[model samples]
Target: MRPSLTPVPLGVEPMTRSILFEGLFVHGLPRNEAFEAELRQAGFDRGDLLPQYPLRLFRQCMDIACRHFYPGLPVEEGRRKLGHHFVQGFTRTVLGGAVAVGMPLIGPVRFLKKFPEHLRFDTSPILVQAVEVGERSFRMEFRTGVGLSPHFLRGMLEEGLRMTRVNPTLRVVRHSPISFDLHITW
Candidate 1:
């Protein structure tokens, strides 16, 4: 469980003495319902084997991850595949676990979206700069302000990354955006 402190809004100046970053990949997303209804109406079966969550609450992290890995795919097609794969994965896992995996799945899903997984970079503000050298990565900025503590700052920086899952043939990484101005062309 995350400690009792509140998280700073993203893009706001951070309130810590140092900064860090981490990389992540995610899985086990639940499907949302509105999309399910839409899918059924469109003649796509909301397969009994792969029941999904409501659309407004759907966790499309894996979908976003796909777009990152396969950058050239059309957005709409990627979106569809993402939804399909999410349901397949979600169903397969839960079915394997059987009744034991009941309601608790939702708890973590809801919690993570509200809060997020964190990944930290090397913990030093002085070495940081905004540069964009990689595709799908962005230059993010942070500053130490009020409510700043070494531990909390570290946690905040690490949020939003999910790197623990070990199955599936996909990969995702969330590193800090490279500094575009720091030229190192070889």
Candidate 2:
């Protein structure tokens, strides 16, 4: 059966919307009338920052944007590419500067452990945990109540590690309806 497209009332922070549009722009997605229409259909206003938009709205807009930019692209690949763009765009923000200063000293594993402190998940139900498994390896697990795509998370983690100048190897050790595990090594 096709998944329902009913909007879920998840209050995402304004930065999340900013980062998403910035990422789409960086990837050359047209921010034209059709894009605005998608956003509207997803229940967002074009002129206002979506500080409390539904999670489904974000997901629908992202999916539409991806398809518009790259017709016939695989969903997973589109998600990965979008995620990569997200990290690149996000790192230019003020928070990224703070993250950069500590990445070299704390490393990706520990950096991830502290990542949750930066998020404002007042409406979403996503939780992240990082556990060290070896000297240079860690397992980062995400327990998501919302149906976030794993490929997107993988790309974000991969790019995050790369930003730290760490050549990372990532593997999906587990995936279920509610949780996913990523084994990361540098």
Candidate 3:
């Protein structure tokens, strides 16, 4: 993920103890491992959350855990706990938006309100911006540096889809001029 927030000035490390990274920032992400364990114990059915879960949904789940117990986790702590998972999930949402150009809820940002973990305008490498697109679709055009591998990207996508009701036809576009896409299909 591309890091948007520059590290704080010298001796500001303490302020960023919670940053997490998937492929980018790898700094203070959020976490709720204890809550996850409880979820398994409580037999939280995560019915369709098979191999993976959506990043946004994951955020929702994480928030639930935090509210229920891990209140100590601040913004950075939450980001660290979420780490790459959070970034990866949001990345999918970013890419999904471009492809959803024809769909109203394509970006589905409203959905994120309930699932409050994904960062807004993160500098993480997973998402980047170009002037033409402005911040409209940064990751959609970003492809200069190393991009995520298909194998890993697919997994992240699958996980993201599971978290929400993704339109299956929204193919995972990889290895194109742009790295990713959330296109429409019949």
Candidate 4:
């Protein structure tokens, strides 16, 4: 099913750091002038990125990445691909360098266990609840004002797990305008 992209309540806005954009463009799609130009049109100039930005701008950039790199895929699939790129790029950034070095050493289970803590690196207002369901598996629930689609989170989690050298399977059991539940196993 397609995840909802409902807007957050009025007067409430979610925010993130510029490192995310840098992750996607500089680390994810490095040296792609076309992608850079597209972002420049969308009011995000990679040359002069902000330290923090609202979720709306982040969504716009994600849209651009989806269109630029995965146009042939379905919308959900495209966002998933973008999510993978986000993590891949994010880990390459100075902010995420620690994750790159540490995730593999700790492995997937530990990573998922510490996922909520890792998310603290972002300034976005989000609440995460993680529960271990079985060996090598866990369920994570997220509540956020940011309207991020489930596919993106799924892809991001999947990629993060893969970085630890384990093949992962993820599914969204429930989704709402403000919250979602993701189950993952490797």
The C-alpha TM-scores of every prediction are 0.21, 0.74, 0.26, 0.86
Model 2 per-residue lDDT tens digits across residues 1-186: 323333335563322434454444433243577767766667665566544455566677668767776567898778776777677766665766566566678767667677655543445667777778888888877776677767777777888778767888877655776678878888
Candidate 1 structure quality by residue, lDDT tens digits, 105-135: 4332332233222222212122323333443
Q: On residues 10-105, what C-alpha lDDT tens digit does candidate 3 reach at each position? A: 532221112212222211123446555554454332322343223333334445554544367664344333433543534435443453343344
Maximum-lDDT candidate: 4
Clashes of each: 26, 0, 36, 0
After the best TM-score superposition of candidate 2, give how far the Cα of residue 78 lies from its true spot, in angstroms. 1.2
- C-alpha-based local distance difference test score of model 4: 0.80
Looking at candidate 2, what is the lDDT of residue 79? Answer: 79
Each candidate's lDDT (Cα)?
Answer: 0.30, 0.65, 0.35, 0.80
Q: What TM-score should be assigned to candidate 1?
A: 0.21
- Sort the predicted structures by lDDT, highest score first: 4, 2, 3, 1
Q: Which should have the higher TM-score, number 2 or number 4?
A: 4
Error of 3 at 125 (Å): 3.9
Per-residue error at 70 for model 2, in Å?
A: 3.4
Which candidate number has the best TM-score? 4
Question: Which is better, 2 or 3, measured by lDDT?
Answer: 2
Candidate 4 Cα errors over 4 Å, as ranges:
1-12, 121-123
- State residue 46's C-alpha deviation in candidate 1, in Å: 25
